[model samples]
Target: MRIMMLKGFLVAALLLGTSLSHAKPLVLSSLKPLTLIAQEIAGTAADVDTLLPESASHHDYPLKVSDYSRLQKADLFVWIGPELESFLQKPVANLPATKILTAYDLPGLFWPDEASVSDDHHHAKDPHLWLDARNAVTVARAITEKLIKLDAPNTDLYRKNLQVFASKMHELDNRLLAQMKPASGVGFAVYHEGFAHFVSHYGLRQLDYITFTPEQKPGAKHMQQLRERLSKDGSCLFLEPYNNLQATRDLAQELHLRIGTLDALGTQSTKTYSQLLEQMATDFLTCLTNVRH
Candidate 1:
């Protein structure tokens, strides 16, 4: 009887300990690539949540009433800056600063603009910095730090995961550099000015962009200018998957140029973030070379 009781107690204790260690702290309100990187670092340890769904646009996102209540429950909340997801600013400010972090600090892309007419896209200095793999590494490291600090028990796992992720990003940078270096001085124009880091890292010229930013379409004069510029430069018109296509197609047809749609957001189901980086580098090489001069 004594042996059986001891065995039963041991089994019960083991189950209780397992359940306690695996219990997850709620992380709430993720946006865009920052969420993806956070999920990668957190793995299955915590319940990672996103207020905005994958398909939803981060810019001009409205907060749900339920989200306000949910924010009260979060152990940690991650978001891009005011440029991207400003809706969360007021609520997040109420929380301790340690619980809130901005992924935009992870090295943003630079856009050169002498153009006039400040539109929605040019409003916040390009918040799509997380699309770049190099920037993604910075994001991942920041997230890992938070996760480790919040849950020290998983420190080893987070560090290991971050190291692996960083290594992959470094390898991707090298691979892209090799592929893009040969095509030096190549010029191309995106529908928006989101790819500053991408173009700069690849040494491509992006003198004119059609859309002021991803969320807003260009005006008539801007379209005409872009069309004329495309015809003269022999560079391809790169459209983003999430962008409004009517203006882009109109300009492409008018200029008799082919359109290349790059997946800036890296679709939720199709390509993993790392694979998308490789695909983008390949697309740039292919598109720049194939365009008719």
Candidate 2:
């Protein structure tokens, strides 16, 4: 009886040890895209949360008192740096260097405005780097690295998740490469110059944009200039969320172009980064083929 009780106590102790594993680390991301990346690495090993809503523009997002508290409670914070979220510069500066990760800090990230894309295809430095799967993989590795350091108990899980994320990203890249090949050299315009990373990554031709900033409406003369230039070569005009849908419809009708909306902020249903990019490619192909989604 004593020997049986000893074995039972040992088993119970082991079970208790397994049950009382490391606490789940909280990774707070500035955007949904980053949050998705973090989620891939964190999985069930950590809790992932997004700091910004999909509806708000990162350029001028108003931070609330609650936002500060969230930032404080997080074990790690990830963002795209001042280039994208200028509003975060001051607040994130308060965090320790070890706790905060940004895109500018990562190497091998493809910035479209740089030598990554053609001059004709590229416009300016695009802050939306997560549009590229390769860049997203890079970010996933960084997040895993930090997670492993912060939550050492789940290092294996984090590392394995990173591998899976990278593999999926490669699969996504290959699929997108083939899918976009059909639409390559096809001229499409956007509401703003934000899709350069996705456009250049997939080799689609972006002819022109309606505005530099989404809120900055071009004057009549400027509109006329775009109209004259694009009326000849532009085949499709893509609008994004928050764009004036009626105006885009009018312009598309005037230009005799197909219409589609490319969402930089992934939809309510978008759970993964791969899903977001795949949806973008599908939307692009649909627009090119004149099959609106």
TM-scores, all models, native as reference: 0.79, 0.87
Name the regions of candidate 2 deviating beyond 4 angstroms. 1-22, 113-124
The 10-residue segment of model 2 with minimum total lDDT is 113-122
lDDT of each: 0.70, 0.84
Q: List the residue pairs that clash in candidate 2.
A: none
CA displacement after TM-score superposition, residue 183 of candidate 2 (Å): 1.1
Name the regions of candidate 1 deviating beyond 4 angstroms: 1-22, 106-125, 291-293
**What is candidate 1's lDDT per residue for 82-167, written digit by digit as tens?**
76667767877888888877876655433423232224334545666765677788877887888888888989998988898889
lDDT of 1 at 285: 69
In terms of lDDT, the poorest run of 10 residues in model 1 is 109-118
